[model samples]
Target chain A: MSHIPLEEGVPGIRSLVMYRPDTGKPLYELAQVLLRDESPLSPAERELIATYVSHKNTCKFCASSHAAAARYLFDQESGVVDLVLDDYQSAPISDKLKALLTIAGRVQEDARTVSDEDVALARSFGANDRDIHDTVLIAATFCMFNRYVDGLATLTPTEDAAYAQMGERMGTIGYVLPQKPA
Target chain B: MSHIPLESHLPGITGLLEYRQDSAKPIRELTQLLLRGESTLTEAERELIATLVSSRNQCRFCTTAHKSAADILLGESETCEMVINDFESAPVGEKMKSLLAIAAHVQKNGKNVTEGDVIRARNCGATDREIHDTVLIAALFCLYNKYVDGMASFTPTDPAFYKKLGERITTVGYNRLPGGYDQLKTQS
Candidate 1:
């Protein structure tokens, strides 16, 4: 049971968002822009960053659903998503992405700890200002999202299929605010 | 002195928002809605929640900026500091104390907040909206703290700057930067 009364059968942040549409609208808009909009990073790469942060935060709902989304976006390259989640440093991805993930990981643990070297390292690997900015923002935003979902103890459906469908929706349609329950 | 080439003239989150206006739009709107928008929680109480979370995260810029806003909204300079230092004994209402307790739990880890905390807050007269907003505010500040510090954005040392910034946040609300980001750049 959630701490507050939320729409039943709605899962994760959806339930919380439906509970308060005014706040939810901006949150979903931010997610849509951050993940789905044009940037130096692909939609797949952006979703991977969100997944990595949620996984580190130990928010099962965010991690799993985002992981599924990342996988969906990755398509035939889906194995890279799991590889990055398992251990991004050892994963088979570009050095630039690895460097960005290093910075993202630091942001997850302690933002102050992300030193000048971290930024320089990412730059050395071909990451520009926009890339670094997007990576850090994505990581930071998910921290809030993870906390929001878990803080309320929102429902987390316990099945892979549910997450797969969520991934398809997120990957295909992007983030849309859930309507208020009728 | 930021990792990225943010506007040196601006300070803290101001510089970050200027760097990327597109993302900053929703972020600013969210802040305005959460802090200045309608809610059962008073503006003072909401600012206090943000301050406490930033203080816990140890982001000096966020802590001081929000502390100033909270102080002004509360009309008492000491309560914000008192709550940041030790809310358990701070001179606030029981309802605020309980909500702050829940905010504290969310700051450490959202899962740290238990049913007991929510029930206690309700018992202290906190509405579901208040509790919900409190958690969101706390969570939102966590993102802000990380965003400011992760990029190592500027942190003004002068107290006068924060005073003006606080007044701006309270009076004008958070939707737009004073004079807009472009005008700010030209002045500098």
Candidate 2:
């Protein structure tokens, strides 16, 4: 059961969103700009960043949700998302992303830990300032989302079926949820 | 100087926000809405929530800045400090202390906040709206703390800067943060 009496049938951040919609619109709008918009990072890469942060935060709902989205988008090897989450350093990904993930991991634990050397490594791997900026933003934003969902103890579906449906919707339709206020 | 090439010399999000104020409009707008906008929670309470989270995150810049804001809004320069030192023994009402406890759990780990916690807050006369906003404030500060610390932004060491800024925000509100929103409007 959730801390507050949220509407039934909604899960994760959606339940939280439905509970207090005043905050959700802006949060969703920020998500659209960060994840769904045009940027140097692909949607999958962005989702990967979000997943990594969520995983580090130990928010199972957020990790599984974004991982499903990335898996749908990547569409390559099975359990690749799991492999990346287990260890992105050894996961099959670009060096730029690997370096960026290092920074994201530092951000997940404590922002101050990400040092000048981290930025240099990412830069050397050809991640420009924008890439670096977005990676940090994605990581930072997911921490908020993860906490919001878990702090309230929102419903997290156990079945992969829900995640598959959600992943397909997010992958095809993108992050803009209908502002049809609850 | 900042870890990154931010325009302002002051450390923390101020410099980062100044570095690319365009990208900061969403953040600024969000801040204005939550902290300054009308709601069940007072701006003082909201700022306290922000301050507590920053303190837990150990983000030097945000803790200083927001504690100043909460102090100014509450018209007590020492209340925020007392709360930070010990929220339970602080002079705040039981309800606020409970809310702060919930917020602290959010800072450490959200899942740790339990059903019993919510009941305790409600038992203290907090409304659903108040509880709802507290959760948002806690989560929002996590985003903010990370943003400031992730980039190694500059944090002002001077106490006067925060005192003045805090006083100004308590009066003029966040939308009119000097050239911040004004400059962004014209540029965009």
Candidate 1 chain A: worst-modelled 10 consecutive residues by lDDT: A173-182
Cα displacement (Å) at residue A85, model 2: 0.8
Identify the leading candidate in terms of TM-score. 1
Off by over 4 Å in 1: B182-188
Residue lDDT tens for model 1, B33-98:
999998878899899999999999999999999999998998889999899999999999999999
State the fraction of real interface contacts model 2 keeps: 0.67
| CAPRI accuracy category, model 2 | medium
lDDT (10s digit) by residue, model 2, range A97-179:
99999999999999889899999999999998778888887898898999988988889999998998888887888776544
**Model 2 chain A, poorest ten-residue lDDT window?**
A173-182
State which docking tier applies to candidate 1: high
lDDT, candidate 2, B1-188, per-residue tens: 34457655345676666655545666777778888898878889899889989998999888998988898788786788988888888888899999999999998888989888888999999987787778878988999899988987777788987886677667876563665534433331
Going through the candidates in order, their DockQ values are 0.85, 0.72
**TM-score of the B chain in model 2?**
0.88
Q: Candidate 1, A148: how far from true, in Å?
A: 0.5
- Clashes in each model (backbone N, CA, C under 3 Å)? 0, 4
Give the C-alpha miss distance for residue A146 in model 2, angstroms. 0.5
